[model samples]
Target: MKLFAVIGDPIVHSKSPRMHNNALQVLMKNAVYTRYHLKDNAKLKEIVNFFNGVNITIPFKEEAFKIADFKDKSVVDIGCANTLLNKNNKIYAYNTDYLGFLKAIDNFCNIKNALILGAGGTARALAFALKIKNIQVTISNRSSNRLKHLSDYECCLYSNLNLHKKFDLVINTTSAGLHDTDLPCNEIILKNIFSNARYAFDVIYGKNTPFLNLAKKYNLKTKDGLDMLLWQGVFAFELFLDCKKTKEIFKAMEIALKLP
Candidate 1:
């Protein structure tokens, strides 16, 4: 069986193995997916020496981006990699975060105004994904200094979430809600945002987040990162299959990972 894994510093909580293994079983593919925790990002190269390829996650996405011999422009824009492919003798990296993010918002008809809650690599991918659709995206983060590279866009402090303007979409890209708790931001801010927001998205998926709960309380359409997680796996599986029985494979994955 071909070997694959998701690599990161803190990977114990990842459901990627369950998701991917389900997909493999549904598609009858000969593959094994696992998770590996690395103390250092530099160990990625050494790990790649054995495995065929691996998915990347937080804290290491940028490091994986740096080491990839070739990078898709989409991954370059995100400054990270969520999917890595070992092609020929070169390691290539791509970011399916946008693919998953795009799939999350594909059903939302109008998304002209949106609020993004972090300034990390996933946030960058989401911002560009929004920009691609010609939507205006405003980002709020703790320290606006590290976001100098994103200065060209409208950016502000997280405290300014109470501004009078109403957003059509609000996405929580921070790790804040992963532990089943909301960010330190006031509850009133979420009430204010989701009151007018049409949809909400949180990138943390192991469970329904406090952020999503607050959005749902306002009757706003909300989605966790789970579908994005599943679809990205579908996207990567297509690459892994190299066009062999693509539709059959994806349909099976979709059924196996069907969302409630």
Candidate 2:
């Protein structure tokens, strides 16, 4: 069987395996999907070469991009990758996260400006996507040091988020709400920002994270990462099978995620 897996540090909670495995069953593809809780970046290339295809998450996307033999234009533009395919012992990288984020936020609201709360690989993907849509983007991270990497966009420290002036959407691209009951920024900061925001999105799924909860308290439309995960897995599955008939596979994966 062709092997595939998603690699990340805190990967135990990932639904990529279940989502892709179900899609494989629907497509009758001879493939298996699993998760690798990878803690060390040094082992990424070794683990990826062992698999036919792999999905990357969190801190490893940039590392994956750096080691790939080839990268899709989107991956190159974003400087990160979330999907990799091994062909003839060479690795090719792609950024399904951009496509997935676009699909997830479709028709949600008229976003004139967006505040992205992180400075990691995912943030890069999101910033790129939002800019493509012509939505003004501002990035905020806990520290100012990482802001330098995102020089194209206006960036600031978490404590200085109010300097942005205005925002229509607020996105939590950090892992602060994952595996813990913590907000990405201080409660007062979030409250001030959400007071005028129309929507809030958290890249951490599978639970009502404190970030989303705070958005709810402010009466903002809230979204989790579940839809993004499903769509990105669908795009990755298409790459894995080299097929385009994704309607059935998409339905199957959606049903699998809804199972009790």
lDDT score, residue 99, model 2?
86
Q: Candidate 1 on 135-168: residue-level lDDT in tens?
A: 9999888887747878647988878665678899
Q: Give the worst 10-residue stretch by lDDT in candidate 1.
A: 241-250
**In candidate 2, which residue ranges exceed 4 Å CA deviation?**
none
Residue 40 in model 1: lDDT: 83
Task: Choose the strongest candidate by lDDT.
Answer: 2
- Residue 60 local lDDT, model 2: 95
List per-prediction Cα lDDT, in the order shown. Answer: 0.80, 0.90
